[model samples]
Target chain A: MQWLNLLNANFRKEYIEMKRYLPNTLALLLTFYIIFLAAFFGIMFVGDPASFEANVQYSIVSVAFWSLTLMTMNFIGFSVVTEAMRGTLEQLYMSPMGVWKIMLTRIVGQFSLQLVMMVILLFAAMLTSGQWLSLNPMTTIPILTLTMISIVGVSFMIAGLAIIVKQIQAFLQIFQFVLMALVFIPLSVAPFLAFAPFVKGVDMVRMVMMENLTLSAIPLADFGFLLINSMIYFILGLFVFHRCEKLAMKKGLLGQY
Target chain B: MEKIIEVRGINKQYVKRKTKEVITAVNDVSFDVHRGEVLGLLGPNGAGKTSTIKMICGLLQADAGSIHINGLDIKKKRLKALKHISAVLEGNRNLYWRLTVRENLEYFAGNRGLSRKDVKEQVEKLLKQFRLKEKENELVNGLSRGMQQKLAIAVALLANTEVILLDEPTLGLDVEISYELREILKMIVKEEKRTIIISSHDMPVVQELCDRTIIINKGTVVVDEKVENLLKLFETRAYSIKLGGTLSVAQEQQLLVKFPLCTYEGSSHETVVNINLEKSEDIYDLFDIFKAEGTVVESIDRTTIDFEQVFMEIVKGEKAYAMA
Candidate 1:
């Protein structure tokens, strides 16, 4: 009950925090419209018989999907580190909650708020692309699930790096500059042929997207390397967070700027 | 008196690996805070007051020391001890900045395990008490510093811990806000009868709220006494002297040797001296030395004392362990 209570409080805080960005909601909507136009009209004007909206197997959807997911992940992770720098971290640390409870609460809170964005994007894309609604639910479900888990891993990594990095402003700037550019890599690779371009990273995303990823697409080497990587990365993030929490407390910056 | 919190020989040593020099932040500090009393943990900047408070709250782990809170060992029973304490830390940075005052209150109250119904009622009560009823719906980030501070204290109160450790609660707050906070704290003390340990440099707050004070300097306590007692102790030291004439060189030397700290009130045509008596009979020595100078003492008047002067005197005069 107490843990649930904590989760509720965190959820409330997160909701209220995000609500102040209500003005930006219009901007987010406009961006979604632009992406839809780019997918439908841009490709049409280019005279490609490929109707991106009509095709369930379209690469454009995957690009837009991953971009939105990674953006949400980045927002949540950066917010935590920013709060740490601004000194709200100490108040959370001293509350009547366990360390794990505190971290889980924040993560869940961020996840819940970010779900709204995910929902909005999903509906906008699905509503515009109405013909491709009910194709391959079984295959799509696993890929979607794995992507969320991997996004969580990426979120954890960003949070961990935020804690370890010196000069928070500089770190965040550098991180955004690199990661925003990196989001297009998945975009660029999704449109390419499997064996033609033969890039290293896309093969990995495709490998995990397969039904028999661990057994067929790849050997059982590294004990299910993708699964292992996600798990290991999340654990290491938790470890770094715990250490940074203690360090800030000792330095008396738990409530300091 | 019942001991609500006992800190025994707490030691903290911070080692900077690059320089390899160990800076002792807290050294063998031990004290007891009685139930239902305000114990001011007074110290100058860098005097380890913050370190000691954080350790008691279980936000920090002391390198070596045992802290028992309400008879539960802090290190061994960390959660239990921490549950007994809540701190309104410095700068009012505790509350979630984007949450409204009401939301922040409800959030913390819920986190502390108050039921949903109680949280609603209690939050309303707190908003009224803190005078933030109108601003309850406003985001904390948009509020003024005073309002945010009041909200932070309101949040701390939501936890309803037995002991409230306030680390510089009045720091950076305007006079009126500080007064309001102090007033609210006083009410909480009386109504809840909660034991409070306030670490502050605000002497007036110390005088108004704290019954006793433990003054620390350079990671060690210099004085631990009742606030009233400290004021009274230094109240006797303030004196104004009436003189007959100026002093000879030998007489001035004798007077300095006897009093060690005398001010020549040249405009008033008197020599005022304040001395901590080594012995009660030291007055006879004072009389004889000044008498030899033919600087006739017309009258000696004791000045009324205040807490500020007492603080200065106590901090200025370090004890020499005379018995040793």
Candidate 2:
């Protein structure tokens, strides 16, 4: 019951904070869309007329998918640094709830908000590029859920590093590009890539969207591997996060920026 | 008074980031905090006051030692031990800057498991009590420094814990707000009977709010005594003397050796010596030094002392002991 209360408070706080800074967030998103996605689309569609429509579909869908993965990971990790810089890390630490619980609450709050934004972007690409992206929820939901579990591990690792390292913007920037590569590179060309963090989930979702396959149609081996990957990563992430938290407290650096 | 907190042989060391040099922040520091008693933690810069406070509240673990809160071992039963304590740490950095005053109060209250209706009532009461009723809806960042500080304290109170740790609660505020906060704290202590441990450089606050004080220097406890006893101890031994003329260097050196905490300011026409002796009987030794040079004593008067002077004398005593 108390944990529920903490979760509700964190959710409200996150929502209020987002509303207060919506204009700045919108401006940054607009700039990112123009510079990053627009440039990629232009480069991909310029070469061949025969492949123009295919390029439009691939580039637009990939960009939207990449944006979701990149932002999800970045927000989870950078939220820790932001709180420490704002001097609220110690305040949160002072609560009766453990540090892990507090972080989980914030991550859930942020991810829920980001999910809505990602859906909006997906539809926007569909309307602008005239690409009829798969809108099926039944097949897509299970794959996305598994992928998020793995992404959460990355987020936890970064958040832990943020506490010990103090500044992580440079690290997050490099991580974003790595995440893009992991999400965008085709799995068929390198089937071994499915062993990587979010690669299997992305491959499965792309298959379902482009090929009209249902959850029942996917192979059991593929589904089992994705589940195992997420579990391993999630547990490892928790281990690292707890280790970093102990170090931060021992160093008397938790409240310091 | 029943003991609510016991800290024993606490030791903490930090390694420098660049050179990897080990520095001790708290060394075998120990004290007891009694229920409903106000304890002052006074120290100079980097004297480990903050480290000791952190260890008590379970924010930072001691490298070696034991801390028991309400008879529960902090290391073994951390959450249970911490349930009895609430802290407003590092000035006003403890509050959410983007949240409204009422929101901050309600959130913290909710974290402690108050029902929704109870949270609303509690927040309203605190808003009125802290004089933030008019600004309850305003964001914390938009409020003045004084208002932010009051909100921080109000948030801490919402936990309804038995022991409160206030670390420099009034730092960086104007004189008016500082006085107002002190009055507010005095009222809280009077009405609530909660045990409070205050770490501050504001000697007046220590004198007015604390029943006993533990003064630390260089990561070690230098003095521990009741506030009234400390004042009386200094008041009885401090003296101001006007000299007929300046003393010989040899005579001054003799006085310095006997009373190292003394201050001597001299001119051609007159000289003044202010000294605090460890014992009242040390006055005879002081007179003997002046008598050796055959210097005439114009006047001798016992000086009164405030808590600040007592703190200065206690710290000076530590330095003098080190020199010896």
* Best model number under DockQ: 2
Fnat scores for every prediction: 0.52, 0.44
lDDT for each residue of candidate 1 in B92-194, tens digit (9 for 90 to 100): 6787776777877887776665555767777888889889999988888899888888888888877878888888988998898889888988888778788
Say which docking band candidate 2 falls in.
acceptable
Pairs of colliding residues, candidate 1 = none
Per-model TM-score, in order, reads 0.79, 0.88
Docking class of 1: acceptable
lDDT of 1 by residue, A141-242 (tens): 434444455455556556545544524556555655454345434434454422111122333443343222432434545224445544555566567666
TM-score of 2: 0.88
lDDT for model 1 comes to 0.67
